[model samples]
Target chain A: MKEYTMVVLVKQVPDTQNLTGEAMKEDGTVNRSALPAIFNPEDLNALEMALQVREEYGGTVHVITMGPPSAVEVLKEAMYRGADRVYLLSDRKFAGSDTLATSFALKQAIQTKIPDFDIVFCGRQAIDGDTAQVGPQTAEKLDVPQLTYVESIQELGEKKIKVRKLIDNGTEIVETALPVLLTVTDTANEPRPFIAKKLLKYRKAACEFDLPKILPRYPQFKTKEELKNFLKKKGLFIEMWGLEDIKANKDDVGFAGSPTMVKKIESITLTGKGFKKIEPTDEGIAHFVAELIEDHTW
Target chain B: MASNGEVWVYAEHDWNKLQDIGIELLSKGRELADELGVKLASVIIGDKVTRHATILFEHGADKVYACEGSKLDNYDTAKYAKVLTDLTGQYKPQVVLFGASARGRDLAPRVASKLRVGLTADCTDLQIGDFKAPDGTEYKKILYQIRPAFGGNIIATIVNPNTRPQMATVREGVMPPPPSKKGKKGEIVKAIIKMQNLPNLTSILHREKTEKKVNLKASRIIVSGGYGVGSKENFAIIRNLASVLGAEVGASRAAVDAGFIEKDHQVGQTGTTVRPALYIACGISGSVQHRAGMDQSAKIVAINNDPEAPIFSIAHYGIIGDLNEVIPMLIEDIKKRRVE
Candidate 1:
């Protein structure tokens, strides 16, 4: 079997489903701190697809994410689920990035860190933005073919890969050459649960910022560098990279590189007045039906 | 880079018939162009789609760029993106619009990335407006791409101040198609497609266009259920009401996510937008995202046990009761009234 090298992109998004009034600031910006961050739902599907591919073809699944330093939590979660390696791309310069600028940064990171990737998997869209643009845009930036809304991998040969993708009112099976990008959908597969053994082993994984809290607990490690070396020896270090690590242009990595800007944001509020109340009795129902008929609403 | 002061819409089609979203965009494109004092153009790519240009003109396009070839009959992302990008480079239109359908979502991002311009997805509204940046820079007469974000909790107006040919994709049924004129005149330009060296990367082995199982867009009345509908078994009551009233069934995102109904029946920001004659929301709390889809209906009725449910705010008739009891009575009454 040909051992393939795969990369899966993931994100930690605010749980929008369980949002409260405090989820939005008075200025119409999202109060991300008020909401709990979880691994993006569909990204788990992408991770599962990559793990399945690795299981069948004897390969390694590398997971990567771009966000704040706290995003390393998702990297650790990926390891618990079966990822072989994890990397975090974080920097203050990479803030306020739209999908286009975000794709450029991810493409640069991929080129710098994992240039020999055979397949790159991404979720169809994240719940936060729901744009579904970054995967295809990154494929365009990387100058590779893309397959979006992939439901399954029909066949995988040495150089060609066949995939079934969902479309409007139908589905299509397409064949593309190697090094193609795929955006997996929720319908693709059920994500596997965390392995207890892997959970116990990878729970100690720590990134650069996590060392401040983690190192103090262990007096044997005198310095952060020594702690990092020890974690690296134990395969428990989560790699962290910034804009410089990926050789990204300052003008192309964040707000300055984004072409679109938010002009205004209005919080939605429902306003209802002067509605006719109806009783839920038999007579009341009959009267309402008769009125509906009179108004031709039926 | 300066634009050519024209608004362009990508005219998607099935065979020779223009898709609904394409026509809807032309209607919007015409309004935007008239506001800016410019011409409205449309780009149609398919084999022998020149006749469709007349329909585009009737709808609202003042100019149609027809790229005709046998190989272009079926949609190939690479080929279509190349044609649109090349035309954009040549003409430099001030604004471009695409339908946020499957193909549009797949192709728009590629073109936007290739041009390094901004592209907003699933915009609910677009207008010509002015924008002032945070650094005191100002832009006038740019496209204000308005869309709901954060699960429709807030509406954001986005502007591409520094990028030319501001691009955005609007979902179907969000914008209404303009009335067709008996005879409308427009210039038809034949675009020369150069596909010699482009890599033939993807090959479609098979395609199955299933008959659309549900089309809430065309329904005159909709009976929608929400998470409060309880469970999959209780959804039968909703179906009974819809069948009695001769209405199509719809569901909110909550109901769909709870496995109470199929996603096709979802009427919300993430599913389908519908403007029906009558919309009866059953046991639905009416989140902002759900209201964004069906709020345009002519009349709305809400039935929920909780009086504070947001659905009652927009509803013309508010019934505060259990849907299980109210729906059965309503169904029986309607059935008896029809015979009488």
Candidate 2:
């Protein structure tokens, strides 16, 4: 039996899937008030796939996320399911990063926070951007192989990873070497429910998945010892990593590492109006129905 | 110029069979190739997919790029990316088009980002040459890549002038395939792709294909129901309509919420986005969410008593009456039309 260590990448997004006009920020980013924070739908699936791997193959599932301090909520949600550990990659410097810069920031945090993981999984793309670039770009940054549109992770062995990828018209079976990144599509797998006890206990726990960053705001946490005490009282599990923590070169560690840049942000509207419904004349409607019958494609 | 370089298309395969989109892409690629005066090519990477390669040539690929091996047998994201990215860099095709299928949606953007180019997803239309510069302040010459935006309410033409190769994903069946010779001979460009070392994190143990699957987007005809149907029981009207038309049953978000149908049957922004030729929207209010999915239908017929229903805004025909009366009447009329 080959042991495995899986890392799932998550994002703290304004529950835009459920967001309304109310969540609209003046600048187009979701208004935090209007949009409730939630874990991305695909990221949850990635974590679930990881947990299942651990359940079947026996290993650890570590979840990591990059966002504002509030992102800890998403990491905790991962823990409630069965992730052995979670890491929060929160830094003010990480703000305003597009897909290119965003992937670099996350690669740094993943490298520093989790030393060794056999595989890395992420949602095919973040729903907010729907760009679907981060996972593949991250794979490029990590210099590992990547598989997108992954519907199923078919096999996990020491040397290889096989997945049933959902193609447009059919399915493709894929096998690749490990230590690879995977961007799971919506068809990947449905997430299991949160563990009752874990959810109940940690329901109110402060989302302090990153200790170093949070300590700066709470001056009362003057020392590591004091912060640990406060964390204990708060029952906060703050995963920690610093610039010196990983084998990261300063040049390629942050904004400098990314290649693509967003030149401008525009709130552009796209419309489509076609499908000329023939008038509901008995003759026209009947002919249309006949056409439908001939096509056999309802 | 489209003619300066060959038109590159991402030919899709499902291990055993080639996707219809691959052929559809080839058909469009041939058109684009003609528009630009170049060749059409398909990229196939898998194990023993020669059968598919022959099919690609018939669909109109002037050339085929096939990488066959045990490692290439099944798709490994990392491996496929490296392989495809390396191919793109070497071939340097002007435009690479995908099907906007689940796999295409995921793979296209990754390749685009890797190549530092621009990509448009879920497009319903494709045209060669320049597009308007959407820049508010300055009018720059940009590659007008247009796609349905705001849930199919408008067509947003985007561009990535700064990048090298432009990429776009078209929905299935938008461009029908041209008649191709099943065994047409074409030159196969075999390449040696180096596999990158990767980590093992998670794996799949089983695959049970019995999930509530809905292939609405792929259907040719869709009988979509909406809130005007009143109750879940009214869906029988839709089911009947579908049976007469031999069409797949679809629902608006409202109908899905009313328990008229499963989420899989729901069509909209949050549901399955389809571009069927004939769309019959019964009692469905054309919310942006609902329209996003079915609005791309080649033809739309709306049935409702509410004359001002938003659906009528786009429907080709609107019947001002109850669907219960209209649907059954229409079903009988169709039965009569069949005889005629």
- The candidate 1 chain A region of ten consecutive residues with least summed lDDT is A24-33
Residue range with the least summed lDDT across 10 consecutive positions in model 2 chain A: A263-272
**Per-residue lDDT for B250-272 in model 1, tens only?**
99999999999999999988789
Tens-digit lDDT track of model 1 for A1-298: 6788999999999886666667757653457578889999899999999999998887999999999998999999999999999999999999999999999999999999999998999999988778999999999998889899999999998888999998877899999988988999999999999999999999999998898889888799999999999999999999999999999998997998899999998877666665899999998888887798889876
By DockQ thresholds, what CAPRI class is model 1? medium
Q: Which candidate is the best by TM-score?
A: 1
The CA lDDT of each predicted structure is 0.89, 0.70
Error of 2 at B246 (Å): 3.5
Cα lDDT, model 1, residue A66: 98
**Residue B320, candidate 2: how far off, in angstroms?**
4.8
lDDT tens digits, residue span A80-143, model 2? 8878777777665555555656666667767666657678999876655555667876776676
